[model samples]
Target: MAEIAVVAISVAKPGHEELLREALEGIVGPTRKEAGVLQYDLHRDVQEPRRFVFVERWESQDALAAHAQSAHIQAYKKAAADWIEHAEIRVVSKIA
Candidate 1:
């Protein structure tokens, strides 16, 4: 099966940029250690400080499903609920 790539974009609520970034950063270490994680990277927008993105690759759809249900991800959702203003997640497969 082909690998799955995910791009997750998050925007922090006005004054909560720092808190959102910290919360997002906290999950990186643990997420990378997951069974089917191939790559996991976090990036901040140069022009928009409150915007953050996650670039991730997983071995398969099942792996990605597991990631979604992981405890750390669940915790992050709860922790950043009030701090985040918007979030968009996309999963795609490479064509070439």
Candidate 2:
């Protein structure tokens, strides 16, 4: 089995927590249902309203690459177009 871990940190527009949550729901929901996905989770900081994180595990790099091409992911990008301030995504391999 292949494992892929990712962290996405993003800052959204002020008063956009609800919007961000909706976007995240779209992301997490579909991502979890992805063919190669094993885990997908969302996180938020209690003290930080605009900060969000997503943790995902896929079957392989090819699976992750396929996730990038999904229509829902595209919609997520479009829905978050102007609201997202900055995003940092990382793909990691766990140490055995």
Candidate 3:
């Protein structure tokens, strides 16, 4: 199966930027250790400090699905729910 790339964008609620950031950062180390995870990186917007993006690459769609079900991800979702105002995830395929 072809690899999959995911772009996850999260917007923190006002006054909760640092809290959200910390929660997001906590997932990085554990997520990177998961099977089939090619890359897992987090980025914060320079102008919009409350916005965070996670760029991830997986070996396959199944791998990505497994990642979604992982404990760390579930924990992140629960922990971030209160602090995040908006969240979006896009799974894309490479064209070139």
Please write out the lDDT profile of model 2 over residues 1-96, one tens digit for every residue. 468788778888887878987888777877788898888889887898788888888889999999999999998898897888778899999997
Model 1, runs deviating above 4 Å: none
Alpha-carbon RMSD, each predicted model = 0.6, 1.4, 0.5
Residue 19 Cα positional deviation in candidate 1, in Å, after optimal superposition? 0.3
Which parts of model 2 are misplaced by more than 4 Å?
none
Q: Candidate 3, after superposition: displacement of residue 72 in Å?
A: 0.8
Residue pairs with backbone overlap in model 3: none
Question: Pairs clashing in candidate 1?
Answer: none
Candidate 2 residue-pair clash tally = 0
Per-residue lDDT of 3-68 in model 1, one digit per residue for the tens? 999999999999999999999999999999999999999999999999999999999999999999
Better of 2 and 3 by lDDT: 3
TM-scores for the candidates: 0.98, 0.90, 0.98
User: What lDDT score is found at residue 35 in candidate 2?
Assistant: 94
The true-versus-predicted C-alpha distance at residue 3 of model 3, in Å, is 0.5
lDDT of 3 by residue, 1-96 (tens): 999899999999999999999999999999999999999999999999999999999999999999999999999998889999999999999999
